[model samples]
Every structure is written in C-alpha cells, then in structure tokens.
Target chain A: MLVIVVFVLVGIVTALLWASLDAFGGNVEQTAGVYSTIIFFVLLVGTLVTPAVSGGAINGDRDAGTLATTQVTLATTGQIVLAKFLAAWTVALTFLAASLPAMLFTVLAGGVRLDTLAASLGVLVLELGVVAAVGVGLSGVIARPLFSVVTTYLVVAALSIGTLIAFTLGGLAVQTERTQTYIGIDFSVGGEFDPVTGLPEEIVCLEPETYSYPVPRFDLVWGILAANPYIVLADAAPTTFTSEGYPEDLFGQIALGVRSAQLPIVFDEVIDECGAALAGDPNSAYEFETPQEIFDRTVPSWFVGLAIHLVLAIAALAAAVARTRTPAGRLPTGSRVA
Target chain B: MTSTAAIAVEGVARSFGDVHAVRQADFEAASGQVTALIGPNGSGKTTLLLMLATLLQPDAGTIRIAGHDPVADPRAVRRVMGWMPDVLGSWAALTVRGALETTGRLYELGPADARTRANELIELVGLETLADQPARVLSRGQKQRLSLARALVHRPSVLLLDEPASGLDPAARVDLRVLVRRLAAEGCAVVVSSHVLAELDEMADTAVYLDHGATASAERIERSRATARDWRVRALDPAALAAALEAESIVTSGTDHLGALVTVSGEAEAAAVLERLVRAGIAVSAFGPAVGDLEHTYLDLARGEVAEQPVIDSTEAPR
Candidate 1:
C-alpha cells in the first residue's frame, strides 16, 4: 500500500512537470524550477508515508507474539532496536528511489547544479531517516502500535506545519507602531515642465503629512521558522539568481522569503517628493534591495534545524533501547512481555 | 544443586505490580529427564517458564539454567535454554521454513547450518507438507508446531515448553510426547508445563506441583501421595463385584456404568483387594487407579487435604 501511494504521488508530480515543460519551452531556469519542485514534492510524500511504514515496528511484533521469541535469541536489545531502525530507513529510501526518473529527467534538461543536487539529496535522505528512527523508536517505547503510529504522525506534523503556524502567530501577537511622513509637490505652482525631469521648473510643496499604524514585528519571531523542515530544505540548497539579482527557482524563492524576514521593519520613513524635485532628482527618494542581496546578507539556519532533528531522533531511540532491555524489570501496566 | 541438574531455581519470586505471579518457586530439572510442571489455572506456570527462558527477571531469588544466571548472564543462559511460550506467535509474512531458518540465524548459526537445521526441524515436527506456506495460513495446531520447531532450532541442552499440547490433536499429542521423550533421552533437560495430567503421566518421569505461585513442599507432596485414592474395579458381573467387595470389607465409593470405585490406601491395598475378588470366584475385567498419579496429587493439593507432617527427604513421588 505504501509503495502504491509513493508511486502514484511521484507519477502525478511527473505528469504535472511534463505538462508545464510543454506549455513553456524548457529553459535553464525552468528546468531548475522543475528539479526543485520535484525534490520538494518527494520530500513531502516521504514524510507523509514514513510514519505509517515505520511506526508499530517493535510493538506490533510484541502484539503478534514475535518479539519475545526474538528476545530469547542471542540478539541483544541494542541489536534488535538498531536493526528495526535500519529496516525502516531502507523502506523510506525506496520512496525516494521511486521518483528517480523524474529527477533524472530534470537533471538531463541542463539546469540543476552539481552542488545543489548533492546537498538536497543528502538532506532528503537524512530527513527520511530521522522520521523512520523516530517512528521505530516510539514503537518500542510506547506499548501499543496504534498509539505509536499516531504519535509519530504528530511529531512529523509538528516539524512540518506547526513551526510555520507558531512563527506566524508569534509575530502577530507582538505588534509595533510605525510612523510615515510624506511631502507632496504642488503642481498648481509649477511654471514650465522640464523635458528631462518630468517635473515643473518651479515647484511649491504642501504641508508634510504624517500617519501611524500598528504593524506585526515579524523580525522578532522569524527565528521560529528556522525549525520548520521546509525552511531548512530551502535554506540549505544553493540559490540561483537571475541577471536582475532575483531568485530563479522555488528553493531560492522560499529562501528569499525567510532571509528577507530577518530585516527589521523601519519605524520612521520620509518621502520628500518636493525636496527631490527641487534638487532635480526625482528617483533619489527610494531605496531597494534585491532578493540576491537578502540571500547573501542573512544567516543560513538549515544546519541548526538538522542538528535539532538528529538529537530528537537519537534521544527517542535511546529511550526505546532502555525500555526494551531485558530481562525486563518492569513492564508497562496492562502490557504483556510475550 | 546436583551436578547433573541442568536447571536449578531457588526461591524464585516475580510480581507484576500488585499481582504476585510466582511467589516462591523452587525446583530442579536434571538432564536426561522429563519433568512435568503440573498446575491449575493461574498457577504461575507461564511466569516460571518465562523466567527460565530468560525473557523475564525474578524479583527475588535466583534461577540458573545450565549453571548460568538468567538475569545476570542471559546470553549464557539463552545459549543453553530454548523456550516455547504458551502464546503462539509467528512471523505472519514468513514461511514456516523461513521462520525456523531465521530463528536459527538469530541463535548465531551459520547460513548453511541454519538452512539445514530448519529442514531437519520441519521434518521432525511433521510440517513437511506446509513447510513452504506462510505462517499466517497455519491453523492453531500448525502454528504450535512451528513455534516448537523454532524453539528447537539451536538444539539447546535445556528446553522449557509452556502448555505445549493445548492445541494438538490426539495423534499430534502422542507424537509430541514421543518427540519430547526422545529429546530427553538425548540428554536434554525438558520441563513441560500443562494441565493435561494424563498426557504428562505417560511422558514425564517426575512431576512438580505448583499452587498459588508456590511449589508444594516436599512433606506436603508426600502426604498427598499417602492419602487413599479411588480405584476403578470392573468385573463381568457388577452384582458379584459389589458383593465380593462387600465381603472383603472394602467400601465402595460409587458405582457407575463402567465399574465400582473403591478407595485404596496404596498399591499394596489395591493388589490385596484384587486378590480377594479373584478368590471369591468373581471375574475381574479391569482394575487400576481411577486417576493418574499426577492428577491425584494435584487434586489432593487443590483440595488442601494434605496432612501436616515433618519434612521428609526431597525424593520424587512414585509415578
């Protein structure tokens, strides 16, 4: 059943990519977009399917009466737990292997860089392994298979979507007031229009207008987004930029969103249109930074998120090993060892 | 502990929170002998077996399988002990052969040796016809056999079987008895726990009685053995048999369609009663103890009718 689900999801993504490639003639940027999109979807499907595949590995064996038999053998508790984790990880990797054709096609289209491919695939494999380890570990620690499976799903959901929700709510909960001042030029007083400057040679400025409103301080809570798996994947991949210093693919685009969030909102701003007109420099009133500049200026947080995930996986497995060691001293209430 | 004893348990007690599953179990099973662990429901037979199997630890007391502590050195104990739990569990996805082969491998057998051992066990347990079939397809009896075969994979010197004959047919039960005896004869110490006393009577050389998580003391077992028990006496003429028993001053407990039951003190009394019946010109058809030895002792212990006596030597009761 898991294999079928993986194949169907990969097939749908492949068909969608193929259709898009036909509609818009495939270019280097488009092919790169296709590869990034494929990797993202594959990661999505892998996380969704991994819990059901790996959960209930140990407790289910106990329920079926096979665990005690294995326990009585020469195999130690550590060996048994490690073997289950490895088996579940292998099963999860098979899902990644299922989408190999689509990934290969995108690579052949001449867009994906060698570094981007290596980093994304490596992180994808590790993320899948993390999920598998947690699932199998929870199975041994929890007494019932059903509860373990649900708990595994909750863990995955917490890392995938919970962080995003928390970041948004945290940012919204802390609001700040911002003031804006705007000075307008009076066209009624202009004598003659300058051909080069599109503004009157003589200008009369109106009274400066000032307004203030509350704004969400996203900069204060943007660190919470660093814990999200999607954010980690995006931030870890190498970004590609266009000639205009804009992101070209989905990874760069998502990374740009997170990187741009790091900048603090300007509370005081001034728009002196009359002053600029007086100086004959109408374009000098605005300041802009491209996505590429944001990407370069912000700190990358994928390694931190990956480290946190690795620690969680290891802690879960270690707890399971401690609980499962025998000769078992204390069994969970209402649980049978055999 | 005797040098020949492969399993020596002393004051073994295990509890699950509020429930004391095995309070004070003490017994020794010698190699080359079949020891029957006889008990009624909730007697902690399975708990004791688990401790011996090295799957559980005793809260107080020590268990030695082949002279190695199960709790402290389970690896050594496991290397010499094979346990078949009362609950039958198999790998549903694996074939019978595959399950056995995997068990052998888990015991640290080489790949080729594991395969050979699996085939040999399949034939030994009469599972040749279903050897290649998935374990999920097996009936309760077939699964029982597979579990037994898996236990024997490593050919340990000591074997622990919990309710081994529950789901077996009469023929299969007979085969099981023969196989168990053969294993014992091969110098393997076998401890079989079961409620089927008559079956154990024909197979086990000695019996251990457990009641309320404790083994019956030696004096208690001896007293139970000394109590008078019923003997079935059948003759060609029921009237003549009753008259002959009356003349011989033997009290008849009851009379059924098959025969008249008379309580006898021991084997000598039973023989005297039969001799007197024959001297009275009555033809005896069948005459023997109404229940197996283990059943009588078990019933006596369950009834709490054991006489208070001084502790005697801990020799086994007459089978």
Candidate 2:
C-alpha cells in the first residue's frame, strides 16, 4: 500500500510537470525532452524505493522468527532467496507501471522516438531489478534488518552520488599540460583596419605565441561515471539530434556530455589570426565538432555499466544464499536460527 | 541407537563460541510415542531440538531423523520432520488461512492441495471462525495453535515441539495435549520439551532428561529411580492415613492438607504401602508419587550432580 501511494504521487507530480511544460509552449522536441525527464525521475524514485522494499525481506523474517520455519520446509535456501528477489523485482516494476498514464501523455505530445523509448525503459527496469537484488542479498548477509536496510541505502548512494564525485576527482587528478600557439595579424604595422571584418589591411603575420595550460582528462575516468545508475540510464538511451546538431532530449544531452569527455586535449593547438583575417571571417578559423558528431565517434559505455551492476547484484545474491543455507555450522554472534 | 528409531542422536554437541549449548546428548525416540525432553532453564533442550529439526549443525555428532541424517541430507529429514519453535511468530499481514496455505506451499504442496490442507488444519486447530482474520490479532494461545497447525502442514512423521505449552491457558493446554497424543497415536514420533512437568506427565509416554547440556546416563537414571522417593497418600481421614502409615513401619516425611507424605524405596514398595493402607480400613482417595516421574528423576539427578560437585554452580555447569 505504501508502494502504491508513493508510485501514484510520483506519477501525479510527473504528469502535472509535463502538463505545465506543454502549456508553456513546449515544441515536439521539447515534449520529448519533458518525457525523458519524467522517465528519469520515475526511474530514480523507483531505484530509491526498491531497496527499502527488499532490504528487510530476509533479516526481518529472521528477526520475526519466521525465516527458520521457511528454511525447515522443503523449500531450499536457493528457492527462498530467489523467490524473494523475484517478488521484490516485481514490486519495483509496479512503480513503473503506475507511471504508464504520464508516459502515454508524453507520447501523445508527439516526437517520441521508438528506440529512445525502448532503450530507456529497458535500462530503467534492469536498474530497478539490480537494486532489488542487492537489497535482498544484503538482508540475508547482515543479521539485523535495520542495519542491512541502511547498508543498502548506503550502497545506492555510493553508486549514484559517490561515482560522480570519484569521476570528477579522478579526472582532475590526471591533468596534462596543453601548449597552444596563437598566430596574430600585426595590427601595429597597419594604420587602417576593416571594422566589419576586424582585420588589418596588410594582414601581416606576427610571431606565433605559445601558451600552456592544464586540461582535466575526463577520458581517463569516464568509466567511473559509467557505473552511475543515472549515467547508465541516460547513456543507454538512443540519442536524437536536431538539424543544427543539437540534442533533441535530456538523454541526448547527457549522453553527449559523456561522449564529449572522450576527446583528447590538443597539446599544440594553432589558432591562425593572419589566415582568419585573410579569409572572410575571423570566427570561421576555429573549428569545433557538434554534439552529434562527438556522440557518433565515441563508444557506448552503458553496456559496461549495466554488466557491472548485474554482476554485483548476482554476487551479492550468491553470497546471501551461501550465508543463509541451513543445517548451518557456525552462526553469527548474537543471532538465532529460529 | 537403532536406525529404525524415529530419532537417534549420539554424542551430539553444539556450541556458540565459548558457551557449550549442548555438550553431549544421546537419545532415541521411537515412533508412536510422545517422548518428553525434560530440562531446566538453559539446559539446551531447544538446541538439541534445533539439531533434530535440521536448523543447526552440531559441532560433533550423528543425528538421524526418521532414518535420514539431518546434516548429510537435510531435505530428506525435513520432508519428514516438523518443528514448532519455542518462539511464537506469525506473518502479521497474512490471514490465518493464508499463512497456513503459504506454509503448505513452502512444503511443496500444490495450490489446490495447499488450500485444502490449510482448511483442514484450521479446522483441526479449531480456528475456523478466525481463519480470515490476520494473524497479528491472535492471542498467545491462538498463535500457539496456529504454530502447531503449521508444523503439521506437511504431515511429517517426526515432530519436534519446544515449550509447546508455555503460554497456553488450561483449556488450550488440554486441547494441545489431546492433539499431540492423537498425533502420536497416528504413529508419528513426537518430541516435546517443556518446563511444565505435570503437562508432560499427562501427555508423554517416555522421557529423556537433560541437565547442563548432557542427557542423564542410563545407570544414573536407574540409580535415581531405585533410590527412596516420597509418595503422597490421601485418604478420607488424614489422621487415620497417618496412623496407618506409622503402624506399617513406613517413614512419614511430612503432611499437607491434601495428603500425608511417606518415603518409599521403589514402585513395588509403594504398591505394598497402598495395599497395607487399604487393609487398615483407611479409604484412600489418592495414592501416587508426590511428583511426576520425569520431574522426580530429573530432580534426583540434579541433586546427585550437586552433591558430587559442590564447588561449581550446578546450573552453570556445561555437561
């Protein structure tokens, strides 16, 4: 019942927020952006609530003196733990199911791509399952229900917030000194300058000036962000680009940020002011790739992150199964079997 | 112990860190008998039962529950063993019938079978009216009945009940006694542990006494039984009974309102005293041992141990 109330509340809030965006003249692409935000919020809330649902599943039974009764039955330890995992996963998915109405509202707003919908929803479901598995596993491994639940929440925080901090710190720690050369037109040599083109009449070449600065190498630590649940959700989604090479939705924007991190800092970058003045425009001299181009060049890390989460979930559950097996030898201190 | 016995345990010991819960337990209980596990507080009756129920592994021992080793093949033993824990815990959110049905499913019963079994058990435990009510609303005794019904869900051949009568009222306790006796009569081996000796006296046909984590040796038990013990003889006239007991050269210990106490060596002498009292023109209302058989033997063993080791706190000794 608590799960239902929480799910409904999140759904209603997402709906109202989406409706406000539409009323404020949200275009097709913006509508898609609003939908991605709603989906991301729903996934975030689902992940947070799933741990609470499953965290007390095993240890709570032990505290209530009900676990040993189940253990004594014909049901093996594997069956008991697996059944709990599946039940928790299903309960977590119900939160997603509750937001179906708002999701439909977003789709009706138009410009919702098929690949984006499928990939984001798939990743969201898998992430929720992973959280559920970890909660149930920790409940078995830890003797106290309260301690295990708190530990589960801590693990969630470490994945969601800790990964980001680590990634930032990691990138800043590994800096490379980049040397950039700037070639300028000798404005002092000419008396008259073109106001429209911002160039000297003679277009005389000045001595190349080299300046060095440190650049944070995010490429070295982007894998840390890969383990972040939010990053995995965003990066896994199929990003859509507009005609101007701008991201169409929140997923595309976030994915672009991760992709942009992959480009290496140019050590000997040369900016030719003389050549720019000789050409039609000075701004035309500097070349920068659009988000779409960077996204296209980079490799996707969502699968790697998803694979790591799945392995952790599996390992936790496997450890729980081993710890909870009956006819048990040594028991944890201050714990009873029944 | 014989393999055919329903429960055969030898040299079974389990410890939790420095505390030896069950140091050395040896006993065999046959099918169709309610064997009482008699012990004082913290004497490891529950620990031994846990081993038999396959919930804990013994540090050193061999345990066979219904001819299957609980450690080597816990599933085989669990299929035939039902354990009613001393602690009364029920799924608070589930209805009485729902809890029973869930327990049946855990025992591998089909949905329909589980429902049917649940209905039958609710009726058997006499909770038909409260079947739909959530378990949290149940009183202590009702919860006990539910626990018993749950343990019986699989129709196990071996039953282990720890402190089964602790919280039951008189009427419920009677019902529990009758139900356990009925189960035993159906050829299920039942082991009951309780501090209530009188209750076991009425229900159990055989008893195994545990003291300080050790089962009483057979020789020690024999010695305790052969030793002189008190018998209460109540008559229509207490004075007449006292005089009659005195006339027969019987040693009178004391007297209470209900009866006069006399020391007797064995059951034969007790019977002889009863006959002599009857011949003396005293109408005997009741003539029996002052305490139940299990309680008497248990107390005697406890006393003998204290006498042998005067320095150690008898209760704290880990046998």
lDDT of 2: 0.88
Error of 1 at B173 (Å): 1.2
CA RMSD, predictions in order: 4.3, 2.5
Cα-based TM-score, every candidate: 0.94, 0.94
Question: For residue A306, what is the lDDT in candidate 2?
Answer: 96
Per model, kept true contacts as a fraction are 0.76, 0.81
- DockQ class, candidate 1: acceptable
Runs in model 2 deviating more than 4 A are A1-4, A19-26, B235-250, B272-285, B310-319
Q: Residue A279: error of model 1 in Å?
A: 4.8
How accurate locally is residue A190 in candidate 2, as Cα lDDT from 0 to 100?
74
The TM-score of the first chain in every model comes to 0.94, 0.94
Clashing pairs in 1: none
Q: Please, what are the lDDT tens digits per residue for candidate 2 over residues B155-200?
A: 9999999999988899989999999999999999999999899999
